[model samples]
Target chain A: MNDTDLNDLLHTAGRTDGTDSFDARADLARGRRALARIRRRRVAGGVLGLAVAGVIGTTAVREYAGDDTPTARQEQQSSSGVEAVRLVSQPLDAGSYRFGKVPDGWSVQGENAFRVTIAKDGDPDTHPDSFIGKLVIMLDSNAPAGDEVTHHNGREFWVNSDGGGDHTSISTLTRDGEPAGTILVQFPNDAGWAKLTMLEFLDSVEVLEGAQPSVG
Target chain B: MRATDRDAEFVEFVAEHRPVLMQAARLLTAGDHAQAEDLVQTTLTKLYVQWPKVRRSDNPVGYARRSLTHVFIDEGRRAFRSRERVVAEPPAPDARREEQVADDHELRASVLDALGGLPPRQRAAVVLRHWFDLDVDQTARILNCSTGTVKSQTAKALRHLRASLEPAVTLKEIP
Candidate 1:
């Protein structure tokens, strides 16, 4: 078919114009409840009940905790640069890590690493604890390239690549105020894929080893 | 945080561009409407979460596109465990079939059939370029393919369409 004919066909078959939103109001309301719940649970759980998975999957899942249970340290608080951010859990020791700048007013809902806190404001449980997102940082040798925002298991995510270049220190962070994990992985930039490092972010890990290194 | 009625402006931003988002979703999903909608939901939810970082970008739609691709790829991994595959078929023929569809339905049937035969990336290459009016380089970035692949796919799509459509045009007209 000619270009004109092809254009006509595509225009007809393209998606229709209309707002397909059916959950805007409900999701927002849920988000509000989430924020409120986060505040109540800031000190709800005791460190005594904290349990670290001694052995994780094929990939090692490390746990970091403070000398005590993962507790909220006197971290800075701010509402800037964070929005709708919620904490999942701080299983890792957060106070012991580097989380960029712990913005003002950001609370630690759960203790370190596994604590679930909210930043700016929102529900701490937007996603299930196990299904929730973690801030990931790895070697950026093979990151994916695109300008599109992405999602998975109801979580939104992204990866950036400039060209066929080699680099290091890539970070996959969620705005939620949880103790992050900084894992390692081999990442190779490829078409339609990122050659993931056989590792995950190892940030915000906490263990009661008395002395632990904190990741930002 | 929670998008309020006060956030009507943000809502407007999303509503105004949903059609294009939906179109992109359709291609990303290979035309599965439900999957496309889920992609949209995930993208929007993330957009809401990082609206500050995303809004600062020159193109929020671009942000959404990358995010949608991320989900699709991640789902490519363990998603088969929980969800049944749609078989990820190519586009069905676009011709309006009245159940008694004729074999010689001209270019419409031919084009769609061609689409079905194409590889996923090749089909994306064609739709993103022609339907979305994206340039070769842009299509490549979206598909994460080389520009050469985009050009090659378009060429391949055209040849197949021509072969299928020319034969249909030479057939008898409906009475």
Candidate 2:
């Protein structure tokens, strides 16, 4: 259409009855909760990511100094006199899933059968960036959870950018070339350790199918 | 601002601008009410997170609108269901309207239908150029493209609209 006709048409097409009432209260409440939830995850993820990176880095340094890393020790024990010497793993529980090797101070916030929100200790509800905001770990029966795949410790994991303002990182736990679950991590823009820490955490996570033993 | 005050201010902002934001989102989503609502919700949530900075900005309204458009464009690519196409058939002419009014609405619907068939960027160009009457430079600023790209996209989109609408509508040649 000519410019004027096209303008008129576009306006008319956008016209609504204006009767659709939005519950600002409900929406605001929902928005607040969602914001809080994101805050928690980012805080928890940020802190946990840093912590894990620190631990892993320290362990690697120690191993390089000729001391055995935890995994290395476990491997040695299995080789020497045992069938399997499981490495000491701390369980971070969310609903029916248990993630082993969570560092201290990180607490599980929200959980369901499929997903769990874990945050660092303190007032994460009020502090959006508390301890690492909140890190979300979820199990998706559907394979290939994220867009990009990268290998860590010889295991393949899918990773992608969520395109959020914080530029959250999404990495999926893969089993036999398929996604078993996902880890969503958000860190401050200046946190150079974000990607490396997230990869390390995903590499070390052990996802159990059912509830944490205590919960069961 | 204190977090509580920031939150209160954001709530006020959403209350004040939700209507207009919903309108733009409705158009961006091609009249899918549910999808439009979801888009608005997501945009508002982002707005809330950045409310402190957004409030200090020169034009909060424009910021909100731009953010809404960006969210729409950004998500439309990643999600399959977010891109809802218009139905094949236009709604029947309203019996309640006078013939002229009904004709007008039908023409508008046809234009909208054609608009729906366009790719997201083309549709955005048409909306910004024809609907909002933005200058090439202004449209470029919103679309994050060069002024020449805005003119080119608007021209191409207008041509598509002309072809689709045919005899009932006419587009002047892009000079």
Candidate 3:
């Protein structure tokens, strides 16, 4: 066929001028719900995965220690300085460690050799000026020894709170009394909610087997 | 801005563009109305997810069109069309103008059949080039291929269509 023939055929083919039957109100509502479901599923999957990993890690430790009782681990938590309660967990894949617990909506925003920062996933394009503060978790593996030691559910963690800015807390965690991982938690200024979340996250800190010292 | 306002704006956009997009999808799917509707829905859902980015773009319509093409391409790549399907026969030609109408219906069916017979990429290239009147460079950008690829694919597709259609009826009779 020549150009004219092709054009005529295509014009007839593409002529969908008034054939649309989309229900915008219904579709938009459905789309919004779908997006919400997707986000929820992601969060749920992350939570479930981390929780399972925690239980498996704890079970292995208990089995290695020859502890038979279910409350054996719970008893250990009471002896530690920090209180233990359940929360959602996360793995900063690069750090070779995971957050034992984190507040909802605090997804990993950035990561590097020195740190992995978690913050609310703000709508930057739409809400450019909206203030959504950060909670940074830094990794410092260069130091040979830790200055302070804190215990949580029988796990020893080295505590170093930076007095300089917004109370940045660097806790070097250990598993089986060895340097398992290091983390630095930074709270935003005037962020009382973040401060509370940071404290809770620190209390739930448990070192996993994968802490390698490399900048991401 | 509040999220509701953004949602409303997006809804407005969908209402305005859905007809044309559905038409394009219908053409792309070889006049399969049901598949075309599904394609448009899928495209619109994607657009909804990226509405903020789309709203900020200089050419939202072009972006949506490109997205629709990509969606169609991806689904075609997945080989989902291998599932069994049955296309119903078209209605009989009108009795009053039986001969002319039957000829016309036969021509339309043959045109659609030829278009559908092409491989997905070749079909997409042909539709974007001829149906949308996009230049080789524009079609290349949308198809995420080189201009050379677009030219070759369009040429091949046209050759195939000509082979199927020329002797019996020119493609222009498709109405």
All candidates' chain B TM-scores are 0.60, 0.78, 0.81
Q: Per-residue error at A208 for model 1, in Å? A: 43
Clashes of 1: 70
Backbone clashes counted, model 3 = 4
Top-down lDDT ranking:
2, 3, 1
CAPRI grade of model 3: incorrect
What tens-digit string does per-residue lDDT give for candidate 2 at B12-106?
Answer: 88788888788677667667778788888988877776665467555688767777777887777776342445556654344432243346556
Q: Runs in model 2 with CA error above 4 Å?
A: A1-3, A53-216, B80-104, B171-175
Residue A101, candidate 2: C-alpha displacement in angstroms: 37
Give the candidate order by descending TM-score: 2, 3, 1
Report the lDDT tens digits of candidate 3 across residue range B66-89: 878877877777663522224475
Interface DockQ per candidate: 0.16, 0.16, 0.17
What candidate 3 gets wrong by more than 4 Å, as runs, is A1-4, A16-20, A45-216, B80-107, B171-175
Tens-digit per-residue lDDT, A181-211, candidate 3: 4554555544333223445576554444444
lDDT score, residue A20, model 2?
68
